[model samples]
Target: MDGVKKISLVIPCYNEEKNITRTLDGILEVFKSSSILAKYDFEVIAVDDGSKDATWAQIVEYAKKDNHIHGVRLMGNFGQSCGYQAGFDASTGEYVITVSADLEIPLENLAKVVELLEQGYDFVNTNRKNRWGGEKKAKSGMANKIISRVSGVCMQDRGSGMKGFSRVLVDNLKFYGDMHRFIPDYLTVYRAKMTEFDVEFKDRDFGVSAYKGSQVFWFYRSSYYRLWFLGNCVSYCAKTVGVQYWG
Candidate 1:
């Protein structure tokens, strides 16, 4: 353990009872096989976003079996970003990353993410070339493009959930509402040493997508987030550069 580093995996699961165990095993398969990754001791923080199913029970069971596993149960159904907020607050690792319990992105892709992080990138966000379902791809695509244009961040897949952050970034950033999706834009303001990596997209094997009908105002929502990002930047600059007394 002397040479090992602690890494935390924050997973936000909602009604993913059927996919809980598989998600854990998939992660195990990645680190178990790699000699480099073997030195990175991993802990799983599975946040139950008030799942109506037995997802919380499954998390509790897994935590009992593995000392590295933990379960966080929210009072009610908060959004995904809120779930991540809970997990982030509870995480105790030098490096933190997130993946869905439904296995949307291949767990194996995490190895590369770990490598990038170890190389000293404060933030690494993935660009998924192919997504599972693009039912609302047109609107989603427009949103991504708009964000990239306004934020001065060239991100192809801004909404890709495959992201990793150094503990320093985790402590400084807070997730709320759907702000997690705009992490890349905020990174520009934070001036974090960041990288963009490509990862393959995989479809979930169990349960349906929770975001099925949430894209009606996708354009409008992204506009609001864009404004939010601008507002935050103005506020951060003011706090840092204003009211300095020159003697």
Candidate 2:
């Protein structure tokens, strides 16, 4: 170990009261058994995105027990982008990782991302293998296919909950509505060195997905958020290419 490699992990929670404690325990267990722990120091920044449940209470409880854990409670549900932004802004590490509070992606898989980061990759993306089964898989498959076709990005799962990147990549990111879901695309536009790997998956143990059909329908009904996402992408591309394209 050349030096202590500091890593900051940020997780966004919304109504994940049932799973947050287990998720945090799993992460700490992973770190305890990890071969890289001797070289790495870690902190967990969990942002409660105004969950309507006991999510914030759980976060505060865990933070009190562990100094390495920090909790941020938002005044209202400002969406995942805002939650991620809060965590990102609070992060102070050479490498930062993002994961969902659902704990769908197994904790041990994070070591591979750390290895890739140490190998000089700016961003390490992951695909959750065997994420769903039967009908759910069928639905996700169709939806993902449509999303890929529309986005023109061929990542098997671009919206995977786990991601690892260096501080430099975080500096380049500007999180907005649904922008976290398109992180790989954004990093590609910036020409950041990247790689992808598969990770173990588990079904979400508690709480329903925040984005239900009715909620999604209503979200798209108001074109403001959609436009905000598109505008950011256009602005990024224009700035990177040094062109005035968004006018």
What are the lDDT scores of the predictions, listed in order? 0.76, 0.74
* Lowest-sum lDDT 10-residue window in model 1: 238-247
Model 1 segments more than 4 A misplaced: 132-135, 212-222, 225-247
Residue-level lDDT for 100 in candidate 2: 78
lDDT of 1 by residue, 1-247 (tens): 6667889999888899999889987777777887767788888888888789998888888788877788888778878777777788778888999888888788878888888999999998888766734556666666677777777777777666678999998887766656676778777767888888878877788999766324633643545545455446424311111111100
Q: What C-alpha lDDT does candidate 2 achieve relative to the native structure?
A: 0.74
lDDT of 2 by residue, 30-61 (tens): 88898875368889999887789998888888
lDDT of 1 at 30: 76
